[model samples]
Structures are given as C-alpha cells and as structure tokens.
Target: MHLTLALASAALIATINANPSYYVKPIEDENDYARVLELSLLFYEAQRSGKLPQNNRIPWRGDSALDDRGLNGEDLSGGYYDAGDFVKFGFTMASATTLLAWGAISWPEAYIAAGQLDELRKAIKWATDYFIKCHVSEYVFYGQVGEFFLDHTFWGRPEELNTTRPAYKIDPEHPGSDLAGETAAALAATSIVFRNHDPEYSDKCLKHAKELYKFANRYRGLYNEAIPGAALYYESTDYGDELAWAALWLFKATNNTMYFEEAEHHYQHFHLKERPNEFFYNKKVAGVQMLLAQITGQLEYQKAARAFCDFSVRQQKRTPKGLLYIDKFGTLCHAANVAFVCLQAADSHGIGDPQEYRQFAEQQIHYMLGGSGRSYVIGWGRNPPKQPHHVASSCPDRPAPCGWSELDKNAPNPQILYGALVSGPDEADKFHDRREDYVYTEVTVEYNGGFTSALAGLLQLRVKSIT
Candidate 1:
C-alpha cells in the first residue's frame, strides 16, 4: 500500500476497532457502517463497463466496450461487469440493483446521514440507464453482453480489452422469464428511489418495468434456455421466484391492485410460501414472503419470514469464525444476502424477535468486516484480501502492459478495490488470498449488493432514522 494511504487507513480503521460493539453485543456504531456504505458505492463505480463519466471515481477505469451492440445494432453498453471478469450479465446485475434499491428505500435516513445518498442513487441509475438501452422493445431485452468463456480466457485491464464481445438477447420465440422479471423488479424498485429525485426518470423506469413484467408473464421460460451461453455461467434454477418477486416490486412501486393480486397468484402457482434455504440472484422466495409480511401484514407471509430467519439464526451452518457458510463458492455473498433479507424482516413492523434477527444479522456482517481474525472485504480492516481474483484491479496503472503474467504477482493488487467483498472463507474459516484461487478470492457486483445493503440497514440501527 502507498505510505500515505496506509497511514490514513490505519487511523480510520482504529476508530472502527475501538468501538466497544466490535467485540460485545451490538451497539450504535454509525461511523463504521457509514464508512463501509460509502466504500460500497465506490466499488460499483469501479465495475462500470461502458463510456466513462467525467466524475468517475475509479482512476484506473476508462471508456471501454463502447462498441458493444446487439445483432440488430441495438446499443448494449453502460451496465456493470458481472464480476471480476468483464462480462455484463443482466440477470445478476439487475438482481444486485433490486437489492441495492430495496436497501436505499428501506434506510434512506442512514444513507442521508452518511452523505452517500447522491452517490448511491447515481450508482443505481447507472444500471437503470443501461437497462433502458438493453430493453430494445416490449418483448426483446439483452440478457447478457460478452460470452463468459471467451471473456474469462483473457486477463488484463478492461480498458485494454480487445476480445470479441457478442451481445445476447431474448425475445418472443426465446423467452427468459427469470431475466426479464428480475430486470423488471430492478426497474420498478428503482423507480421508487428516483420518484422524488427525478420524476421523469422514475416514470421511464416504471414504463419499462410494466412492459418487461408483461413480457415475462406472457412468454415464460428460463433465461439460460434462451441464451445457452449464459447457461454455462449464470444459469437460472427457476423463474417462478422472479415472477413473483417482480410482481411484488411493481406492486410496491406502483401501488396497483393488479400487481398485488398477480404477486399472490404467482406465489401460489410457484409454491413460494415455504422457507427458502438461501437467497441470491436465482432464489427470492424468502424476500417475497418478507415483503408480503411487511406490505400486507398477512399471517402466512409473516410466519414464513419468521421461520426462514429463525433457521438462519439457529440452524444455518456456520464457519468456525461465525460466518454463515451457505455455499463453497461466494460464501460471504450468500451469507450477506441472507443477512440483508433477515434485516428486512427485522425492520418490518411487528415482526417479533427483531432483536434476535438484527443481532444475527450484525454478527454475520461483522464476520465479513473482520469480527473474525481476517477481513473478507478488500481494502478494509487488518490484513484484508489483497490479491483478489480480479482483472482490472490486478493490473498496474496505464502505459504499463498488463497480462496473464501480472496474475502471478506475489503482492497486493496495485489498485485497491475499496469496499469490495470477496467470495470468502471456507467452513473452517480458511481463506487463501491468492489470485488464481478464484473460488475464494474473486469479487463480484452480486457479492457487494446485499453486503452493502446490510451495512445500510445496520447503520440505521446505529443511528436515528429520518422523522
């Protein structure tokens, strides 16, 4: 690390570590969560894939993928790179946005207090604007840009990328209910965030959201079925959750009776009332029920949310360090996603046991923030993950040729990817901070989505909410 940055970070981290709540029961520590929230938004800026904005904060990132276009010459640029790699997978990107928007809506006061409200909204609009371009028509939407296999084969700065990145889309004959529905949810939920800030943009988001939801409902099929290339990487397990999930968001955004009824219909048809084992891009049943519990105060939905959160608290598998070990890949991501959902349940009115759920959520988030021996989030806490399996951050500054050779460097990433939460430790709390160990060290937008949101929710608990 640079001498100046190291000295600065040391003092800042000390304040966080000094908080008594770091070791004992949860206490109001708004500073730490607020700092993490600020850093989280910066991580999204580093993941941008299109033309560079003048106010771009990531100095290493530049205008790339400007030539990205669909088969019909539809512009397909400006969304976030799906992960450490440069591919832009719409399904997961939209899913991340939905979670981020949900957090912004739920904890506006926290964001405002952190002085990150504007940046957070900008982070969201970056994806929403890209979605507008990708939604070329009522039935057609670009689900992915750049093939996974081809993109993964190269390793260097995205600005210097020279690989062929063909855009993939789904239309009437090739339906992708999961992708369409998730995108619809992202737009609808984001519409709520932008309603007062920019009414015109909010209206545009709702228009596209309604159209995409209609397309998803009319032509139902898995996104991976439409685009086989995406199947290899981000395959959809089922579209039912997304269908119901989008309906719920649309209902929340528009307050339309039809959307609420459709959400209920999809919930029953898809059998989404049962507690989900995990929550992420592919599965959202737990979130669906939790939102229903909050919105309708229905007994069935509340019971389901309570059951799911209770399992996460008492029954879910955990690492020696207390991190929820959901899956081997992206362990921290899954844990944070669950943490965010449980936080939603905690914040929901009259959902008894808010203390247990919020405390559980705090422990999980703290584990990522170095409550354990090591920090899973890059550029935060002592001995944070350095050699994250990422391309751009791994590369040196411009005028330097970065290639596969750079991947073998036995040092920290040249550029610090601040606030990036890496796919974390194993069941025994074993984590190897090696770039080639992509299973554990790779960072992604989806990884930060819920982790960042959970930070915001936790921040609210530490500070006063807006009156």
Candidate 2:
C-alpha cells in the first residue's frame, strides 16, 4: 500500500510538471504583475470593509480610552493589536513591489496605472509625506513604546504611593523594543513600495531596509540553533519561530547576491535533515519554507515545500458536525498558511494536483465567512487541542528551563481570523462562510498607506506584462 501511495504521489507530481502555472518565475511579465495586484486589491478592500477583524487592541475597563493600568497609554501595549493595520502596510509594500517590476517590463501599462502620469505624481507625493510621518524612530517594537506595562499599569504610575510617575524608560538602543522579523518585513515591503512609486522616498526606505537586513545578517549563524532553521526573531533580543519571510522578500526585492546567498544558506540548513512529518506542529514556518522554495526554484526546496504541504493537508481537523476546522497556533491558521502554500506551489509547479490545496483553501475561506459573506468573529479554537510548540525551549549545550519549548504543548492555538488571507481572488464563491467562531471586542487602526500607494505601480507592471 505504501509503494502504491508513493507511485500515486509521483504521478500527481508529474501532472504538476505538465501544467504551465506550476513553474515559478520572477515577476518578469505583465500577467504575473496583474495577478499580484489583483490579490493586493482584494486584500485591501477586505480591510476597508472590516471583513477582517482587528483584534490587536487594548480595551479599557471603563468607557474612557485611558485606564489606570498602562493599558490605556499608547506605549503599554505592543503594536501587534491591529490586524488590519499590519495587512495594510504589508499589502502596500507587496503591491508596490509588483508595480515597480511591472514598470521595468511594460512601461505603457505602468504609465496608465500611474493615472496618466500627473495623478501618479500626486500619489507619489502623498506616499512620501505619509512615510515620513509614519517613521517612528529607527525601529518598530512589538508593543507601543512607553505606553503601558504588560499587566496594564501605566509606565510610571506608583500603585503604593498613589502618585503619577514616568510610565517607563525607553532603551536608546532598543527604543522601539519589539523590533522583530515581521517589523523588518514590513519595512522591507515598504521600501520596495517606495522604490517603485516615489523615488523621493526610495533612499529613506533603502536605508532602513539595509539596516534591518544587516540586523538579520548578524544572527544568520543562530538560525540553525532554532527549529526549521533560519527563522527570524520577533525581536533582536529573542527568537520565536524560524521565520525566513524577511529573507525571502529581501532577496526578491534586492536580488543582491548577499541576500540571496544568505537566504539559500538558511533554507538549505533548515531543511537539510528535516522530515516532512516534523512540520505538522508548526505550519506557519512550514508554509514559509514552501514560499521560499517557490521563490528560489531549487529542487530540494521544492521537495521540502511539497512535503510540508502534504503534511499540513493530512493534519487538517474535521469537525464532527461536518465542518472542517483548521488548528490555530498562536494567531496562525490553516487557511492563510495553506492558501499561501498552494498559491506559491501553483505559481511554482503550475496547477497539477492542486485540487487538494484549492479545496482546503476554499474550506478555510468558508469557515471564516460563517456560511456566507456576512461578517463574523472567529475565535482561536472551538475545539482546542494540545499541539507541539514550534519555538525552541533552550540552546544546544545549555538548555533553559523556561525558554521557548521546541514544541509548545501549552501554547494557545495561534488562530488569527482577521485579514489573514494574503492571496487569491476576492470572491465569495463557496469559500465565504459567515459563522461565529470567535469574538474580539476591541479594534485598532494602523495604516501602511504609503505601501498601498506604491502598489499602484505594481498593478501597472502587471498590465504591461500581459499585454
């Protein structure tokens, strides 16, 4: 039976090779540019309508936005409270990158998308101004800088003395304390956005991006120390998951030999001795590995990507009531991660044997929508189950008792229901199901408008590539 299954898998893979959409290519043409732009637009529209949740907010115990616990202050909570805000920034960069590439290949489409040149000029100006204002020091921390303490106490409030004091002290070096891989990714995405549309902002974007790249490079050697190898940290001071996303984006934008080389090194080292089944516990990292593989086009990377996807598919949860449930792992999900993987695969290998992937993505979409396009809040896990944690618990020689566990058995399922879908057409076709899965009472608004503006250029590039 195992041999037969292996043979069947081989045949399915062969079918993928037969399809044209499966092979991955750099965004070198109009069609590719269009696809990315379309996806970006869909994501943006979703955010505008509040179809995606913005659970990254701190709720006040009373009616006032401010509370005694630093939770009311801006700096107390980290910056991760707004899902829409993060997506806006991320998609903006993505769109801009696509447009820039499109312009290089098809100037006419790029020109038209630039709104006959003059409007494009205004857009560029606005983007430059926006980015300038958005620049918060040299780094972005996880929570609000100088806002509130973890327990919701004001930075300087003295509970015993009943006196108002300085909330907290900022680290000059780590001013924006939560400087992490995701923040770097946001910066990199924005840099590409500016570089494509607003030449004026390009220098600023590049400067910050290079700094982030350098920061990441400083820890390249430590990647192997973590599971899935080369995962980026949530901050410079700590490691979380093996996140290679920033590296992938950096390589895509710069095509710099060093970035690509580092990316390759990290990729190989992470997957060299890893098995397909080992990834079941951490699909987000696994999904990222698939994306890098598709982006780079190494056969080994492709194998790892395929194996991880297969593993994820096998591990998907099916509710007794007939609904499919994707296990949530710390603000993560099966739909978003799986869709990302499938899209990358389809873009890399074409569309062969993609039915499973497509079906799974669609199912996830349906689960999110609660049976229709009606919006609903989805919780972390309805049927919460204990799963392995992906974060490392200790070092190789001296393992820390309270450090990140290799597989966190007690970690909250990171299921994020809002603005998580990063790719695909923006249609309700069977995928949009509006059901009450979870609820988040508070919401926050954070915009990466500069990046979104940059995406206009990418759309133009997509049109040019196809024509």
Candidate 3:
C-alpha cells in the first residue's frame, strides 16, 4: 500500500508541475501553506461575477452576468457565484465576505508577507460593492437573483446564460433577519478592513451595517421565507446566531458600547453559548464565542471557546489520516472551518492549551495540503483536482462555448481552476476528480472562506515579520 501511494504521489506531482497554466510558484519558502494562501485568492478571482477589470488574473473568465440587477433595475452586477452553480445567494455570499474580511483583519501581516494584501482587499470590495447596490432601499435588500431549478437545468458558462433571472428581496412585510444580520456583519467587518486604506468607503460600509442591523432587529423572520426559492438551497435555521454575530462585528469595528451590549443581549437571548458542531456559512456559535472572548476577555466566553476547540481536537471523529470528518459532503471544508475557529480561540485567550490547538490546526491544514496523499485544492500540490464541479473553470476558454456536452465529457477541465477548494472525501477520506460527481468534486465560495482564513492564520504564526 505504501509503495502504491508513493507512486501515485509522484505521478500527481509530475502532473501539477507539467501544467504551466496552473503553476503558481511559492514566494521564497516552498512551504505549501504560503502557496495555499495565494491560490485561495485565485479561487475568489475565479468565482468573480460581473465586469472583468483590466487587472483580472483569470484569463478564461470574462465579463459575465452583466445584466444582473435588482427589481427596480438597480445595478447588482458585482459579487460572486455562490458555488459550483451560477446563483448569487445573498446569505451565503455575505457569510463568505464576513469570513474573508475577518481573516484580512485578523492577519494583515500574513497577507502582506504573502503579497496578497491587495488581492484580498479587491476580493472583499467586489462583494461589498454589490451589497451596496443590493441595499436599494433602507428597508428592502435583494436576497437572491437566480432560480435554482432553472439554473441547475442549464450547464454552461455563466457568460452564455440566456434566461430570465428574476430578483427577490426582503422588506418590512417580508423581513429576513438572518440575511440582513449576516450582511450587516459582512459590511461592518469590511469596514474595518478598509478603515486605513479608504476611510470614506469604510464609513459607507459602517452606515449600511448599522442600518441593516437595525432592520434585522426590528423585523425578525427566517431569510428563506422572504425569498422562498432560497429554501431549496440555503434555508437558514436560525437568525439568533447572525444577530449576535453582526452585533459583535459592529462592536469590533466601532468600539461602541451599544453594539457590544446588543451583542451580549443576542448572545444570551439566542443561547449562543452552546458550542456548535461546525462553523460554515450557516452556524456561527463557535465564531461568536471566539470573538466574544477577544472583545470582552470574559472567562465565560473564553471557556466556551476552549470547550469548542477541545471537542474538535480530542473528541471529533477523524479519517485514518487524521483529517477531521464532520460531514459526508465538504468534509475538508468542515474540518478547515473548525481549524480556523479553533485557531481564533487559541489566539484570543490562554484557553485550551494554545500550543495544542495550534498543532491541531497545522495538522488539519496540512491534511488538506498533501497529508491525505492527495491535494483537495484544485491546481496545486500532488494530484490536485483537475476536474472540479465548477461551471466557469469547467468551460473551455473563449469562443469554444461550453454546454451540457462539456459536462458529459470524460476529461480534465480545459481551464485550470487555480486555488479553488473542491468538495472533499467521504467518511473514509476517499475523493475523486470527476466533474459529474458534485458530491466529491464541487467547489464553492464558502469552502474557500474558512480554508483561506486558516491558511492566513498559520502563515502569520510561521512568518511573523515580513521583510
């Protein structure tokens, strides 16, 4: 078994190096984490929607989804595709933005050292700019723009999309507290990210954040109900977590006591102290606890953070190779999410034996890089995924025009989806690079959010001072 694994690893490494289109050399050290951080930024660029700027790094991706607009023809043409599919889900997109912004704010040195600080800001700006458009009115916010059933039927490049994409929104009557709250968090967090570089933009983000937070608290309901189609994919379970999460971010951005008090109120009223199993686009109890610990230095929040990380490191089920196996789908995404949350917990307080948590994070991240004997990230490391279930990258470049035939083809994707993290292995850590097998091959914005955040955290630890 060892011999076979060795041979397979060799073959995968050869394939990766031979593919120049996908190759992105490391800065100075060949430590895979630094490259991982760089490629994760590429993934976000790959997922970009709307106008492709002159500085666009993705050659295959052009200006697509230009006509995406709000109900009143309000331009909402920026942001990103939610996942492998071509839908712009506000809830997931906002959650991803918040995670990315949090990482940038937490570890600016990591990005600067990696020379990804500029790219990172551009990534967050794309989403926030679109969000600024989505907030067409004080009360109303466009939640989604594409229909899933219709979207799933057509499998081609987003640039060639030829169908009606009716927009949906949430107003006073159809209030989506979860959606509003999460967006508020995203904007508030981004406000901090841009505070030094562009104070005006920062102020704008904070204004929207404060208004959205007010909207969320004033009228409460599940976001899926406001936009019924969202129930098919991203049906929110509870708004309590987002309410608290948004308040916490606002407090961090503004250092205002009212927001902190609101954060505490939401924390207790929503019972957010209960340690959550995972920290993805949906659940955020673990993140809340960690952030609370950082902001307040209260033993209560610190203890909760420690409990969550301790459970993850000691009690969580793992594959034979020590990869935390939380769920069947996006297994690595889940593990990375926990790793990032735990890293935050360890960083914020003297909780849970910081060294142990750090080691655990490194182990989990390494498993994603190559410890599993195969890289789960597209276009990097040994035998990385060559055929991720993403439409844009799956499509052949330029005038070739992709369709259902592209989906049916038995070959690696024509274009390399650099840095995109795909749907990971099953229970036993088994993964295949097949475009049709979305369960094991799909990529998403949320998948990269936590993974990249963890990478930045690890990079910060290793390369403390960048010359």
RMSD of each: 5.5, 17.0, 5.5
Task: Estimate every model's Cα lDDT from 0 to 1.
Answer: 0.87, 0.33, 0.85
lDDT at position 359, candidate 3: 94
- 2 against 3, candidate with superior lDDT: 3
Which has the higher TM-score value, candidate number 1 or candidate number 2?
Answer: 1
What TM-score does each of the candidates earn? 0.93, 0.46, 0.93
**Candidate 2 RMSD to the correct structure:** 17.0
Tell me the tens digit of each residue's lDDT in model 2 across 30-83: 222222222322222222211112421111101111222222243221112122
Instruction: For model 2, state the Cα shift of residue 48 in Å.
Output: 12
TM-score of 3: 0.93
Off by over 4 Å in 2: 1-143, 146-178, 219-243, 269-284, 321-334, 350-352, 372-467
lDDT for position 174 in model 1: 95
What candidate 1 gets wrong by more than 4 Å, as runs, is: 1-31, 465-467
lDDT of 3 by residue, 200-240 (tens): 99999999999999999999998899899998777789999
What TM-score does candidate 2 get on C-alpha atoms?
0.46
- TM-score winner between 2 and 3, please give it: 3
Residue pairs clashing in model 1 are: none
For model 3, the local distance difference test gives 0.85
Residue lDDT tens for model 1, 202-294: 999999999999999999999998899887777798999999999999999999989999999999999998878899988988889888899
